[model samples]
Target chain A: MISNPLFFVFIVVLIIWIGIALLLFRIDRKISLVEKEVSEALDEK
Target chain B: MFLYRLVYVLMPIGIFLSLLWVPPANILGDASRILYFHVPVAWVSFLAFLVAGLHSIALLIKKSEILYREAMAYNSAAIGMVFTVLTVITGSIWAKVSWGHFWNWDPRETSIVILMLIYIAYFSLFSALKSNPNRWGISSVYLIISMIIAPFLIFIVPRVYPSLHPDTIINQDKKIHLEASMRITLFFLVVTFTLLYGYIYKITNKLSLIIIKLRSSHDI
Candidate 1:
């Protein structure tokens, strides 16, 4: 009963979604950091 | 900012609906839940590719400045490639559950594989042309050609060749095969995925713009 492949499939999908969400969040954060740095550089100029 | 927060709320609801709220299909059972993710991701991939293709056309026509349009096309293609890969992954899992195999060279499967290869080739060409003086012109032409072929690969080939894939929402009879609850849930998920794609596209484009700005300022 505990070995149902359906359960595994659901888990796999959930994991994929979580991974994608994390990747997007990371990209957004990194881009924000870069933008801040660029604006600061422009301001200094 | 409000839109970003909206995604936070809506995506969770979409997840909840797909994983818990929607009833199982009569035959595929719980495996049917993957449809919510697979279909939306595939749709977004197509949308992203379309955006890329349109930008390519505009780039060729305007010829004013290549950077912005080229960047937009690049970003859109990148997103399209990512989403297409996701579609394949989710579709494969669904297939494993239903077809007892991950792949069997079904027409629908073959078409998607061909689509993936096309985009992969595009990326390879893009990188290979990095130092070429006419990179923008060459890549734009390539993207335009890809855009022309995309529809045939996605829609026509799948229908013309017999497929093991299930009937689409609008089949030959021009009727929806989904139940009301399923249809609504699918629609909600699609909208959520589209919004998610839009959000990603906006940020990525902004990043490109900022980089261009920085580069121009540096040149000055």
Candidate 2:
């Protein structure tokens, strides 16, 4: 097992960064869907 | 779009360089790694606020696409709030490691807290005026006034009072304190985080625009 505490800190930071990235990606995807719907609605008018 | 993909890749590399590649500071040691995250987020927070302020000014001057401009400014402020909170949390963590206490009330710390409060008040005022027709103008003026005060809080206040915060990147002599490798890592991370902020701001702005469109069209 890696014993250094700094390593663990790095791991924690890594996990947080990855989590933020995933959250942003999900939000972007949802926004894209909404954007498409709005564009279609505008087209209909 | 390619730039958005680049954030996913560059961010991990930035993290790696910050935590592993750069040599630990002679005094702060490994705890200094937090600098990579803290400073970048703080810079982003300021950038977001500036963008919001500029958009507010444009909204007032041009007086066109009120919803779009208001949405951009609001979204910027929202992103800025998140990053400002991150800066506080990360700074507190660093302080705990360096000072053996979390809440030191150092000048920079106090100033940042006050800055946060100012923005929080702006947000509260925004929500309270939700039903008012002059909401956009009033909030934009509030933002502009706050922007005027922001520099005093961020730069002047910190300097006017002695603090436990470390030496700034650019010291009195106008020399960078960081060594070359660390400087490079810091710059890389700052750029990557700014790009990440842009990606997020873009998405949120698009969503807000769509909402405005739907509302205007009564198509929701």
Candidate 3:
């Protein structure tokens, strides 16, 4: 079953999943930036 | 406790992967491999939504700070999205091999899409509340309404819709007949994903708490 052409499709989807995961990871990293900014603003007060 | 839970979840995944490398296959043959991923994602997504709905109920009952409720909503929404994406990927692969298409608009597939959209909307509502503290009530109301809609999306819609997904595994309409070994592997995978969901939830919840405190203090 893994030999079937559908397996190729799965491989493509797997790549896409990896890409999305990486993108989400980057977005989450930016969330930390936002948090830091919020902290700095609070400290100013 | 967290370390113990982590070990418990990982051991099964390790064993399952080892079994995959073995020559003689288990109960469901190659199809059983899908159990390692697909079932876990489906189970975890369901569990996340359940958590979200429960938290919504708690917020309504207790009327705690909007921050706590938002944390619950955000964590659930994030996990739900990840699991939903996983379900689509795994299910599509399974379908292509078994049903000869990437998609068939099957009842299960359609219902899952609908479920995914609902969560997407949930997340969007949360994002909208970020600029205005007063919007907390609106977000909470949305969460409550979404919770009310979840049961229908999860159960009723799938069953009622015409689907190519197998309705019966063997002689029974509900039970799938897999060898004991495959069943054990699948059980382990489900447990592993559930634990992973819990770990992620905790981390996200903490982040949300910190953000809330930061916001409140800054406003002062």
Candidate 4:
């Protein structure tokens, strides 16, 4: 296991996967705001 | 969103299984296990580019309704390029361990880099024609051209040319001789990575929509 090259790849992929998930929530919030405004505008029209 | 959540929950489990349970190939020893990670990311890059190319075609299909679609295509391409870069980086890591060097511009390496360059050129063209109303049509055509040549550039050229990269998984007669264990792990990884790609693609689309809305509202 210690000698497996794939073990390292697993570590790196996990890090990147977590990083993307962290950013997703922050970006998701911002986009939700825009979507809300667009819906509101349509309702007003 | 639910799929992505499920993928996240499952992917780590798959990684654990691969890392701890799977045995290495007799020829490749333990290093061959990197295929579990490397192949999936490369597959995602191909899928992302194809999706972008499809969006580009949609640009040509509709005359005045091209705005959001073009932005979607551009964002998808941007994400695809990111994945391709990751593919190269991770592959380089594997190369250093397996081949005793990081890079030698092997046939496979060169072909992937050429695809990257084409995408870079696409962005440059986009910037040059940003203000033109017909930019969408022109850019879409460019993407379509790349899409047409993509299979040849990525798969055929590397195999046809002599290289250090492994031969095609499918032989000339269309038979794959993948080991049963490795094949199963590959399938799992490919499905996991493809789901991850879908999540990112949707996120990119949402972000692009927000950016366009912000621009029209002068919120930026």
Candidate 5:
């Protein structure tokens, strides 16, 4: 096994990757909702 | 289908984690371990552009609004940029260890720089179209031109020039010797990154569709 310090760096990179993935997911979801609202408003007009 | 795809992504992550304990010497070296990440990034980047190119061809043929040509163009360009960066980082590190320098003007390195520039221009063209809907057609045409150029840069350029980079599998003269364990680890890495690419592409394309809808509605 690698040293604890190297292992910690690996864990940190993994966590950061997961965090970025989650952020992108949230942004996509929010964008989708905004688009739906805009489309509905346009239809009303 | 979504759950299955999610499982596909997780499985590679699991495999990669398991392989980390297997010792660096079992592969090329402590440095060879980078291939587990580097080669896959290159492979997935090429695959992304191939997907984008196919979509471009489809758009040129069908001309359908819902065909997702623009989404493919944008998303592939994004992922390609990511992988290109990964390639540079890993390649530089490997070169430092293997060749005594970080940034050799090797044929492969130069080709990658050109490849990155082409895609950067592709993305810039998309940004330029933001102010003019009438330019999408022109932008799409430019993307098609990029697709035509990609194959030559990827396949032809490196072959035509003498390269200092070692080819593990491709070339006959300078093949790096890899143990069986290393080969298996590399295979898993490629699978993992390809799955990552597919997952991101799905998410981004969905997001792009929403943005397109939003823009169209705003214009009305």
Candidate 6:
């Protein structure tokens, strides 16, 4: 329903920003997993 | 990490401010809005190249180098390539709407395309030699050479040749072209995007290190 083209851009950018945030969160979780596993291996050694 | 989270929250506000507050340029009209996103992405892409280049230099100097440092150099270039692609895409879209054509083969566009090719070649070269023991050294050298050419491609070529692209925001005289308020808006956007780039670059480098550790541990 938005007529102004700039508003469309605003919405699209918002969606893109959300998508980027989700990706960063998932990557952070993966980094945490790797950190834990490496520490555990060090402890065993 | 907290800083990273802050950028995630702040980028949206910057985007909205750019969209709602910044007035359009007299010549470029609404299409000028793309400048906020497109140019900032391009700047970050250049920053990524600089990081990779400096790391490549460090790799050459040390007799025994850190694996992740070398890997970080290459990985940052790859991430930079991603943003470079995004810049090209957004710029092309802006061009189409403003100029009524998709491909103009202007000096700036041509230079960016060449820059993209250089990054791709760096990626492909690394992939081709990744299994070899000399892979790091060889690829690092290639990145150095690419970095040498990059400044020419980015700064010199566009400026030397006549182009449809307007003079950069603050030109030689240091006089501002855009309105006073719009300058402030654009400046804030640039700052936010730079922070966005820093967050992404750090996270990506961390992830690459994680991947390296995983690979070594798995003995694959």
Order of quality (TM-score): 2, 6, 1, 4, 5, 3
Candidate 6 ranges with C-alpha deviation above 4 Å: A1-5, B218-220
**Window of ten residues with lowest summed lDDT in model 4 chain A:** A1-10
Q: Please provide, for model 3 over B1-220, each residue's C-alpha lDDT reduced to its tens digit, 9 standing for 90 to 100.
A: 3542463337434443524432334433466466467877888888888787778677767877767786777688688789889899989988887788999988778888988887888778777767886665676677677767777776677667666765423333557665566566667767767766786676577578777777678687
Candidate 5 chain B has its poorest 10 consecutive residues by lDDT at B3-12
Give the TM-scores of the predictions, in the order they appear. Answer: 0.89, 0.95, 0.73, 0.87, 0.80, 0.92
lDDT of 4 by residue, B119-220 (tens): 999999999998997899999999888888778888888878888876567657686667777788888888988887787777778777766765666642
RMSD of 2: 1.7
lDDT at residue B100 of model 2 (Cα atoms): 98
Q: Which candidate number would show the highest DockQ if scored against the true structure? A: 2
Q: Alpha carbon lDDT of residue B104, candidate 2?
A: 95
Q: Indicate the worst ten consecutive residues by lDDT in candidate 1 chain A.
A: A1-10
lDDT of candidate 1 over B125-161, digit per residue (tens): 9999999978899999988998989889988888888
Give the runs in model 4 whose Cα sits over 4 Å from its true position. Answer: A1-16, B214-220
The residue-by-residue lDDT of candidate 2 on B1-220, one tens digit each, is 6686589889988988988788999999888889998999999998899899999999999999998999899999999999999999999999999999988999889988998998999899999999999999999998998788888888888888888887898679798989999999999999999998899889888888888888988854
The candidate 2 chain B region of ten consecutive residues with least summed lDDT is B1-10
Clashing pairs in 4: none
DockQ of each: 0.42, 0.68, 0.12, 0.41, 0.30, 0.65
lDDT of each: 0.87, 0.90, 0.69, 0.80, 0.71, 0.82
Candidate 3, after superposition: displacement of residue B65 in Å? Answer: 2.5
Question: Candidate 6 chain B — worst ten consecutive residues by lDDT sum?
Answer: B62-71
Q: Which tens-of-lDDT digit does each residue in B3-103 have in candidate 5? A: 42563456436444534553575434655566677788888878887777777767767778733676777787788789888888889998888888999
| Full ranking by DockQ | 2, 6, 1, 4, 5, 3
Evaluate candidate 5 by giving its C-alpha RMSD to the native, one decimal.
3.6
Candidate 6 lDDT by residue in tens digits, B95-177? 89888888799988999999999888888888888689888888888888888988888888888888888877646878877
Q: How badly does each model clash, as a count of residue pairs?
A: 0, 0, 0, 0, 0, 0
